[model samples]
Target: MRLSMPWFVRLAVIVVFATGLQAAPAPALAGSDQPPGMIAAVVARVRDSVMRIVVVHPPEAPPGEKTMAKAGEGHPVTRIGSGFVIDPDGLVATNRHVVENATAIFVATPDGGRFRAEIVGMPHKADIALLRIHTGYKLPAIKWGNSDALRPGDTVIAIGSPFGFDNTVTAGIVSSVNRDIMETPFDDYIQTDAAINHGNSGGPLFNINGEVVGMNSVLYAPGTYSGSVGLGFAIPSNDLRFVLSRLEEYGQVRAGMLPFRTQSVTAMMAEAIGSPAPGGALIAALGPRGDEMNGLIQPGDVIRTFNGEVVTDPRDLARKAARAPIGSTVRLGICRSGTIMAVNVPILAYDPHPQPIQEPGPPPKMLGLQFSAAEGSDGTIRGVAVSAIDPTGSAADSGLQTGDIILRVQQQPISTPEQARAALQARAAAKQPYAAVLVERNEKRTWIPVALPGE
Candidate 1:
């Protein structure tokens, strides 16, 4: 807990606790009434561990190509950020946004030592990323602190290169903990008034004991001002440790997925369902994403707790589910039909972004009828996707909807919108009455005899 004090008394509060020895008098500040040497001692131990990150973004690639140019792509953009060493062997932690899409990453030390760094871990659920550098010399690593023990009004120190100024230090009290800035699903941030700005994206936020408690990732600035207005947020150290550990072991973190879709309990729904309070996850949908439950669970079951922890709502359960280990059975408290019972549910691995299947033919283009093609990552053309349709148009009248992909027309396979248009134009010249349009919607295919215009 923090002892709220005047601006002038902060240095004294930390200095007194840092150096509790009675043998000698501590050093004093040059011109201030507050005592000194505590902040200096803390920065002295961890500043060398802090690094200036310089990232070179790869050139924009032409459609379906690795990169636009062969070597030395022109107009390479550079981004600067900050990071701190977590392992002596050169494992550095920073925000993923700092080095995202970076072709090459470089790190510089306070002693002018520089080396190329590589991204080791980038988790989808968390904004944190890990980088590794090789160096023969011994490196200074920062000490880890318990973010769970932190509370509002606790003292904190931020170190980073704000606006390209290296080694800038700012001090403030933690405005709050467990602060959800709506950044991520598992957002538990340490909100402080420290002067964090651009270029401080990945710097470390240290506690009064000089231990690294969080990493400065984001800041708030009103209006057109890009500079700090004393509002900064850091990802808690406890959250970072889990991602780091998983990355080191599995090369990626696996988020646990729930079998059933859930909704937040409302006051009216709670009273109707016999729940004492409007808190818990209400199972909204079952049987599609929920087939794994094996009919043991049903819809309308309110999950009151997960693995013995009382859930505040659906979001709380989601956050807890992400942290749970996959392939493990978790005990859930359920309120169903006015009876409270326990149910064991298995956690599954979540695949957030799955690649779409490609069509294995020509490239994509859109012309008349607002048709576009879906292209896969490896240059393979997918089916022609319908982006929009006129409500009064024949396509919409024949059951074609947005997000439906045109698979074939008139019993001919079509890969692109250009192909679909060409085939239809030929069929129109032949004066066909109705075209058997095969379209895929939501992974299901159906034939719709769309009436040809001017027929």
Candidate 2:
């Protein structure tokens, strides 16, 4: 039931994944034209490794609850996604979002076998999940591809369950690489024209040789549109491989961190910094450890290179730092006061389960509202009480009622009423037909889709 509305709270469509190179010319098969065995051969080779996942959650499970009530608490909510076999011992790979909230998971293969699957491991930050099923015999697994070698216009093939249609194949070229849709601090996504739909979230995006190049993950479309608009994104296989390795070995993914908070240098900033062109990552802010690095790499210093490699931007530095070998000191080329210099900084592994920082929470920020959407000066809406519901309105039709309180819209806390209004308005203006809403009623919370009114 949780079709993740990630960076697309503005554009309202569900996502799908796909990629494949055009097949080489050969003898025509039964079907007909196009190239001989292009897409067909690739699909035939790897389709069996693809998986169909059926997840059952407690109907009353709050949205995004990682662990839910064991199945059969109430009417179970069934949601479907896709995955692929990664190991012959029944290990599977999938998007983290697919099974994050699942109470019960079922995996089906092309050979007519269905088995219960359990979460083997998953990274805290990346959208990658690993599952393991106990199959008596060896299961077919996919061959890994080099995502770093992918280029714009390279072909790709995707296999998944779109709308519960299992093993569905779609192909498209790489639209671009290293896309930053802001999903995470490490946001290098492979943009593709593959038809990734609502149910294609965790499937495999294959190259022409039947090797898995990426995992179908996110998509872009009009808010009201139900189909992919040839704009889909996938987690690159190299990143996926790294996360999987960390998850299996460490029980979590580890990322390397430099001491200071940074942002990309802009043209104006470059001019002020006396640079020839706009480039390099600029240290904009500092944390505690950043204070330590600040002495050597002060604020306003542009990181021109990392370990002798040219640093393109903030994201490039992030990726390089995250994937850098642990305990290794890397050289940072920095420009400060218009002078270039080098400093060796030890890569720091981020603590995944550190004690929660005691936030500025002495006086809990509150907004006045048992009915009206009263919000604090900081723009956080406490609990917007639904004073009344129009019987014929979309909320009412979605089973919302008077006295119900709105908790979040699209996984984000409604900041101010105006921000909430504008976000919904933008989705409506973009012709997005529905808004995913979280509501509390009778002291319980649940997610529901509220249809936005037509223009």
Candidate 3:
């Protein structure tokens, strides 16, 4: 028989075992020298609104079999992601892909309370979705920050569940602003090195002041395992606000169109056009439906401003046009033939499948380059192919080489030498200083501003 141990001895043994098993103290946070407790304070302010999203999909059917499952009868395919509440009534914002094709959705808050969620609306083009849950009590909402005010190197915080770890906090600076990932036409991602991963999609990217400035969405990883490699992208809160407003008003986001294709002005093109610097968007082509503004605005015109806002590049014009109110008249400041002109055009709903306009007549040869009809592989005339270039002339000085096909001059198509000559003569008659020429070289197309002779 063994003797029983004293109460003090038993207590001492329990304490020793518990102390030995205790987890090692967490490491101090890196990358910042904030006063003690600053991070904890910020986290406390917004952590309650951060949430984890769970999506359940119906089971897959057998090969080539149209197997349909009864209510809740199929095997559940589960997906996990993150989201944040933007309204006290249980409205949540998340990535569209997270809830796409989901049979059931659920939201889990920080306090371990879970609720069923329903999709309010999702704009596929923007990759943003809104969800609503019926929480008995009002939930905390995050405050929106001005994304436009963000600059490169500004401190930012990313909050989400990475690899199923709930409420993981990562801090990094803004790697870049106005990043275009090319995933969609409305791409204007805020890039940061905030350790975003697969499950981080739809989580809030906070500014230093605990305000939501972006929504973490995409990670740039190119291997079998998709993990953050210090390159992550987020949707700007400004754009998100616009999408949310449209979703609330019309149940869908509406994109307005300018009905024209544009290119960025190069320094050479600007000098040729008599502009002081390389700025503004050069109109390349207009859609057939854009003919309503044919007389007011023409191809080859440089758009300098839209609705009193300066447009420094093609992307800027596109973004402004997309955000414009449909059917509202807007003013455009255009530079045509080195002269400034104003035109008002009514914005129309964007046409996803716009009809192509008829190609214009042949371009004129103001520069010392001879052009002939180019033959395509199918023996069809594609454009005016360069036959000869005068070595001492403007064409040679502007970098036009032999075999460079003259596609268009001032946005007018060219097929024969005579048409090109006529187009040049028209510019000469108008006393224009130069002509913007579109040339195809080695299958690549570019715009070259050829200075007019005797300008």
Cα lDDT of model 3 by residue, 312-365, tens digit: 787778778889988888999989888888999988787554332211112223
Alpha-carbon error at 109 in model 3, in Å? 1.5
Please, what is the TM-score per model? 0.65, 0.69, 0.67
lDDT, candidates in the order shown:
0.71, 0.71, 0.73
Candidate 2: tens digits of C-alpha lDDT, residues 1-455: 12345434221112334465343332222123337666797788889999987664444545776433322233335577899998999888988777765545668788756666777676656778888888789999999999989988788887898877789888878889999887776778898887777888899999888899999987787765656777888989999888887767765676787867778788998989875568889888776776545377777889999999998888888888988876688999989878888998888776546332111112111111124674545998665765543322323234455556777878678745566566556766777656777878776889876656544
Q: What is the lDDT of residue 415 in candidate 3?
A: 78
Top candidate, metric TM-score: 2
- Which residues of candidate 1, in runs, are more than 4 Å off? 1-37, 59-67, 70-74, 263-273, 286-288, 296-299, 352-455
Per-residue lDDT of 123 in model 2: 61
lDDT of 1 by residue, 100-148 (tens): 6555566778886666676677775567788888887778999999998
Q: Which candidate tops lDDT? A: 3
lDDT value for model 1:
0.71
Tell me the number of clashing residue pairs for each predicted model: 0, 18, 3
Q: Candidate 1: minimum summed lDDT over ten consecutive residues — where?
A: 8-17
